[model samples]
Target chain A: MMDVADLVERARRGHPRAVARLISLVEDASPELREVMAALAPHTGRARVIGLTGSPGVGKSTTTAMLVRALRGQGRRVGVLAVDPSSPFTGGALLGDRVRMQDHATDDGVFIRSMASRGHLGGLAWATPQALRVLDAAGCEVILVETVGVGQAEVDIAGLADTTLVLVAPGMGDSIQAAKAGILEIADVFVVNKADREGAQSTVRDLRNMVALATRDWKPAIVPTVAARNEGADDLVQALDKHQAWLEESGELQRRRLARVRDEIEAIALTSLRVDLRDDGRLDTLADRVLAGSLDPYTAADELLA
Target chain B: MMDVADLVERARRGHPRAVARLISLVEDASPELREVMAALAPHTGRARVIGLTGSPGVGKSTTTAMLVRALRGQGRRVGVLAVDPSSPFTGGALLGDRVRMQDHATDDGVFIRSMASRGHLGGLAWATPQALRVLDAAGCEVILVETVGVGQAEVDIAGLADTTLVLVAPGMGDSIQAAKAGILEIADVFVVNKADREGAQSTVRDLRNMVALATRDWKPAIVPTVAARNEGADDLVQALDKHQAWLEESGELQRRRLARVRDEIEAIALTSLRVDLRDDGRLDTLADRVLAGSLDPYTAADELLA
Candidate 1:
């Protein structure tokens, strides 16, 4: 077993191997995870969490790279969690260009990681929030969570962020359709990427109209960008800053962080309880009772819980 | 204060109001739920569960209506659960067209209900599978569950079903894109709706190619339908029959049913555990520990579970 104190000390001192090993423990759900969490808890809750989500082919990865530069230019240590809830093979192919992400590869101030769900029920693997905690405790000043906006997993990522950016491209028939899918509710900022493309103006106009129609207390700012050319990065960073300021000034940050904690705690508790039930023979006995018509599932579950 | 025995007896006799009341108890997660389940346990496991899913504007509701007619033509009693995990208001709007579904609305042989998640973490509410069990025990020989295929909640529906039909429509730009999103893995059959529309043939061709490319023991049949015109409903039913026969002959039906039961039991047990944490002082104490940095969330959760 890895020593929790040593790992935490090394990870706090910015040891990449220690941090990576800590994350692996979280993913494998090792029994030593509790000790690890206790050790790292003190240094967390200081990072500015920014979530970037968009439909496939919207250039989210490229934009994430650009934002990493913007944050780095501001002298902030940055961490990127590239989360793919799609199939494992597809995620592998997508992350194969990790070398292209090498702009920060040699810089210890930037940490980039790829995470794919291991066939979890909610599209997000159960360990993502814990992994985020690891980054938070590792002295990262800004953490960017990047996920594709195809499933509720991305929405869960939004719940873990202080500010969420919804990226859209000009001609992929992705943005307007995204609005129809409730993507507007979670977005704190709207990014129209590929601004050099032909239909960028029309895309921005349609998005502005959609924003006008939503009855939100905090309206999402729409910005245009060409990440491949490093265009409009400043404006995008400013929008993020505006949202961050709003989050802090309105005390929404405290509320959101508290909710994230509550969710994390509940998830862990539930997972542990499931393991107990499945392994303690309670589940098999109940299943037998249910199958034999002596008891129903609800009653059997109640009995087990009691 | 309803009597469990009375309700179960009435529901078993196929009294619609009794079945509705039982479902309401399931949704509210009432205290008497266990008693109700115990009474109904003997009567379930007899219904054929079929799940139909697709993106918005795919005419799933209309397709459901046609399927209800075809099942009635087979002299079978049917139940329909329309699950909308998007928004309750949208669910209300979609089901308000009950007049448009007049073929099943007034038929004693058909029962239709709408269920929407009330902001549950999993795209599906915790109550759905229990509600399905209630319907099964209430003499529903065939149950059709219709849900939008865009999110993980629909994927949950696929897990609860014996047969899964993925619907696609012409001009929606849906099928191939959905396959890329991992929708093809859970499908037992694919229906290309709106065959009268332009590009229908190409849509069918693309879907057939995708299905052929998939490495599955049982090949998913592709059928064309125009639900608005009530065309090809028989072909769809035949395809369902073929898949059902395959499942039974391959012994996959028993395995799937057993797995479904185990999953249902686990979900109920875990939900109860979460309720205990949230309603008791345990969650607050753990959150306080996590917030104060005295204990990390993972360890705090382990303590609470212990």
Candidate 2:
């Protein structure tokens, strides 16, 4: 086994094997995780994180591939995290999608990983940010975190990125409506993928109205693209650049990064506490009393904490 | 304002206003929440919780109403918690759904409330179980928790129920495919809603195939229903009853309830701890160091906890 510090050092030099191993350590919550994180900490927070999210059929994977291609064209080292918060039951579904991403398989400049939450639902919440740190410290200039689904978990994961791109394909029935209102708030750029489709203009108009309704300093830009043919990739990249520029000028970038770190710290602490509560015999005893109606959950919680 | 004990006492008598008030307290996370929960504790553990989940536009609301009607015909008092875990951006969207539920407005035996998570993501996790406790103590024989979206949050909420009905409608693509596999494991029964639609039979066949793939002590039963016309509701009801019987006979009921209580306690304890971390100035200091790359999040989390 390689030493944690030595592994982090190799990762910092952009060794793909070292990067993959570090991410595995994060995923497994390995015993040396604390040392690994401390070793990598000083090198992180440099990569620009962009989150892409939409419903399943909205061409998120295609758009992601297009963006990765565009970023590589710009001579940038990129990392892609395709996070699936769905059941681990359909692991093959995501693997099939990853195979299509083989467009970058021969390109050493790009690193792509697909992650699915296994066992406990909290596992995703606990592991994703740590994985992001691995990519960031490994000297990736740009990291695209693309997550499946349009639910609250998607919104929560989108919050981890520096910029969030919300994708909506045409004829997907008010794709934004299916996306829920939270996605609108977090959207730094709206990509109307499959823009060659019939309802593309209408989807764009609807998103414009929704954006107009929200009050914020940086109005989210909507970029239309047919990601399958890589159409409008340049426009999407320009939109991303503009958003990053705005983030820096408005001083929101620092603020957002700080908030993200704050949340990551809090989630880690809470997860550790949750694991303790799970392992402790006292929780079972308290749950028994609550189940028996001799104690309320809140009182039981207080007792457990005490 | 009525005393907490008096409110709980009235709720036990199935007073509509009292029950509504108690639920409001849970939603607001009111100062008297702990007291209200303590007062209501002993009366809980009686209601049968049924969770209904499906993708958007799949007739979950309609199926839920139909089941409520059938259960009412059986002379049982019911409570419905329509939980929307979407962004509070479209409050009116769920309100519109709730207005349709006004069909049972005149019936004193029914209590329906629509809860949209406001502010934080953790808000829903902390509030839903307590709200269940409120309905459980208010003499509701069966409480139906109908949640919007087909994400992990829905799965988590479904875990709180005694029996979970996964709804799938025809012509909705592979409706169950869109629903993550975690949903399948949690489902006690599957309702092929919109059975009158063209593809209903095929949908049922697909579900049976999926169910056959998973080996469990109890294979989930798939029932077809046209909930809009209130067709096949009796079969749905029968399926639920049989599942409940199995739950009780196989000792799964006790185990499920115990696990639910254990989760409830853990969530409560973690939520309290989160509130503390949010308010304390130390977290901000830790976040700053993390942002500066002077410390990693895991180490910073340890410091915050210390």
Candidate 3:
């Protein structure tokens, strides 16, 4: 058994191994991990957590790799948590996301980790934000979280990040279908990956027109990029920087961060309560009534809470 | 301004207008609606809630319409809650779902209501399960909830239903992509809708293979149907009946129902807490921190809870 206190201390001092080990502990949901988190919680809040999400094949992984490289080039240490779909058959799988940024793995300034969704339905792996915290505590200046495309989980990502980037690809059928209204609302910045593709201009036009329809406040800028080729990577980074600056200048940045904190705290509390309810056998009794057809679910829930 | 107690009582006695009105109130999230829900909670759970979900254009709506027709043909009263995608411009949108089932809307034994997602990311509308409860309280023997497609929100539908049916269509690309493993694991019965399509047979074969890969003890059965022609509507209903029987015989029905009830209660509670947090202005503070690069979200979250 690893001493969580020792690990926390090492992680706080910028040990990559300690950071990696701490993230694994959190992902495993080991009982001892909670103690480590409690100790490390105070040391967090240093890194800028940015979330990137889009549909599959939207170059999210490549984009994330590029961002990490850009941040590192600017003398800032970077951490990347790339979430991928987990295979149901085998609970254990490789963090294959590293393949996209394999060239940067040997670079001391950049630390990248792949996370599996672990049967979680949302776009984010349940352990992602927590893992990002471990990196933040380890002194990473910027933490980038890449999520699986536009889905239920993706919506939650916006609530977790300081600035959220909604990535889109050209020629993925109707741009509107690819960029659903739900996703459009959350994007602080939109990136048109594969900008060299045929329908790039039209996709950009559609996004601008659609975004124009939704909000009268700050209009999100659409940045064109070919992440695989590293084309326009620097501009994308500048766009992110500009957005961050605007958020601070407008004071909306502080407002969004405050809201994000409240949501995370409430989410953690609710999750804990759910686990307690299940483990304490209250859920079993409620399930029994629901199955018997004698009590409907809504009523059973009320009784359980009572 | 109407009396909630009167509405609950009227709905209990099978008043369609009262049921419709109550659902509308709940969907609108009116404070007075909470009182009606509290009163009707005890009356819910009498009806079996069934969820039908699949990829877009997979004949989900058509299948739901046919299922309602078949169930009603057996002299059982039915309620249908069809969730549609909402437009970004106006929160209010057309209810195209009920149009497909127009034949049954006039029948006293059948009631159909279409719900828009209200910009919520999840497949089933946020107001969907609550609407189903209203129908359940109104003496509907079976309540069928149809989702727009397989997305982040689709996974949530399974947690709400006693039995879940995953619909798929032929030539819809990869079966695995169309019916992602996340949604597949929750399905009790799989229906290959639009079986008249050229690749229907192969789709069924692929589904059978996928079901075989699932590690669950009780294997879900795959049924084929031409929903438009109503060719296999009877078989689809029979499959649902068999699933119900399997649940009863295996003693798993009660267990699953209890789990669903517990989930519903927790979901409601968490939603309530989020609403409270938002109203108390805590969320705004957290959002502010997130926008400023100084505070990491996880630490900020801990502070908010403390």
Candidate 4:
């Protein structure tokens, strides 16, 4: 096996190959992942995690590319974990999206990797935070986690992010759909992409009205942008910086980070316990009893835990 | 404080109120859940669970209502659990969706309940199977679990169902979107709703082309329907019956059931362990250590398990 310490050293120096390799270990759940995480742990908790999410066709890739460009313009290193959909149709389209981000490919300060949201259960849940830790340790000042679709996965991205931007397009019913998906509540900033289109004003108005209804300590800022044209990119970056400042000033950043790590530890612990139960044949035995109608699952679980 | 035995008995007798109460306990994660599950265990495994999922605005509600009508027409007792999105916009829309199912509301043979996918992590994961158990033991011959949205939640529903039907609409980009969300692989049957619409044939053809690409033991059946007009309801039901027969003959039913129960047991065990670790203060100490960089999360997890 390649030396994990050497990889960590190289990653800390902003070596893209080293960072990508570390994340690959995470995504593959490699045997060396535990070592890699240990080496990366002390270097983390520095990167600002910004999550970008919306339904497909809201120009998430375009917005992400624009944000990367703006962040790089500030002379700060950046990383992006674009959580791509693993469908044959879109799976093939991921290359097209990547081509858009090639503007940063030669820049050592920018690291972009796409993690496929495969069909396996908890795959993203297990891999995402670890990948984030890799980027954070590699000295990326800001790590953008962009995910497609508006459902539980989007909510999950919110939980991982320090500032979450919910993207919507004009006249796509995206505002109402975001509201219905509960994506509105989790957003720290709302980006009205394709803003030059008709109905953009109405979409923004609807979002503002909904935002007005909720009394939060920080009201999510609404910014309109035509991502394809790179309009409002500066405003979007400013909005993100403002949220970052508020997060620190209000002490919400530390709290959110602590809570995030707490969840991570709990998730890891639970997964370990589950693996032990399954590998030991205890789970199968209990499951057989439950399937035979001889015992309840709760009681069987209690027994396994005991 | 209600007697668990009495509640289970009433539920077994097809008392909708009792069934609802039991499910409420499940949803609430009540302290007496163990007793309730024990009481209901013997009566489960009889109801064939059918999960219908698709992107929003694809006529899931209408198709579900139509399916309830068709299932009821056969004189089989039915239960419908509509997992609604908990958003202000769609929260209100759920009432309208419920009104459509009111066609069978007054019928004692049909039980309908809507569960909210609230902003809680693992809320649906922990509660859904328990609710299905309640419906199953209540003498419902078939239980339909309908979920709105196409993401991880939809995949979770597929895991819980004996047969999963993925709905798509003509010209809605539902085909590509469904494929992108990876909803295609989880489906046992594909419903092309709104078949009278202009792009219906192409939608069906697209689904067939994708379906043919995968090499599975059982290929998903594609059925076109105008659910609002109640057209193709019989064919959908027949398709479901055919899949059910194949599941039994191919021995996939037992295998799927075993896997489902195994997952259920593992989830319960993990949840119970998480609660134990959290309540005992061990998790806090470990998380704090990990946060302080004194230890990595994986090592801390191992310590807690040890």
Query: Across the candidates, what are chain A's individual TM-scores?
Result: 0.92, 0.95, 0.89, 0.93
**Regions of model 4 farther than 4 Å from truth:** A85-96, A117-122, A150-155, A173-181, B85-95, B117-122, B151-155, B172-174, B177-184
The TM-scores of all predictions, comma-separated, are 0.83, 0.95, 0.83, 0.94
Provide per-model DockQ scores: 0.32, 0.54, 0.23, 0.49
User: For candidate 4, lDDT tens digit of each residue in B160-208?
Assistant: 8999998888996644653533655688999999999998998888888
Compared with the true structure, all predictions reach lDDT values of 0.77, 0.82, 0.70, 0.81
Of the candidates numbered 1 and 4, which has the greater lDDT value? 4
Model 2, range B186-298, lDDT digits (tens) per residue? 78898888888899888888888888887778899999988999999999889999999999999999999999888889888988888998998999999999989999888
lDDT of 3 by residue, A160-228 (tens): 777889888888636355345666678888899999999999989888887888763667878999988
lDDT of 4 by residue, A254-294 (tens): 88888788777766776666567778677888888999889
- Of the two candidates 1 and 3, the one with more favorable lDDT, higher being better, is 1
Give the per-residue lDDT of model 2 (tens digit) for A1-306. 668778888889988889888888876777788899888888888999999887667888889999999999999999999887664223435666798899798788998998765654357777788889999998899999887654454237556988988888888744466444676678889899999999999989888988888788888999999999999999999999999999999999999988888888988898788788898999999999998999988899999999
- Model 2 chain A: worst 10 consecutive residues (lDDT sum): A86-95
Best by lDDT: 2
Kindly report the docking quality category of candidate 3.
incorrect
- Provide the TM-score of the second chain in candidate 4: 0.92
lDDT of 2 at B6: 86
Q: Give the residue spans of candidate 2 off by over 4 A.
A: A87-93, A151-155, A173-181, B88-93, B151-155, B172-181
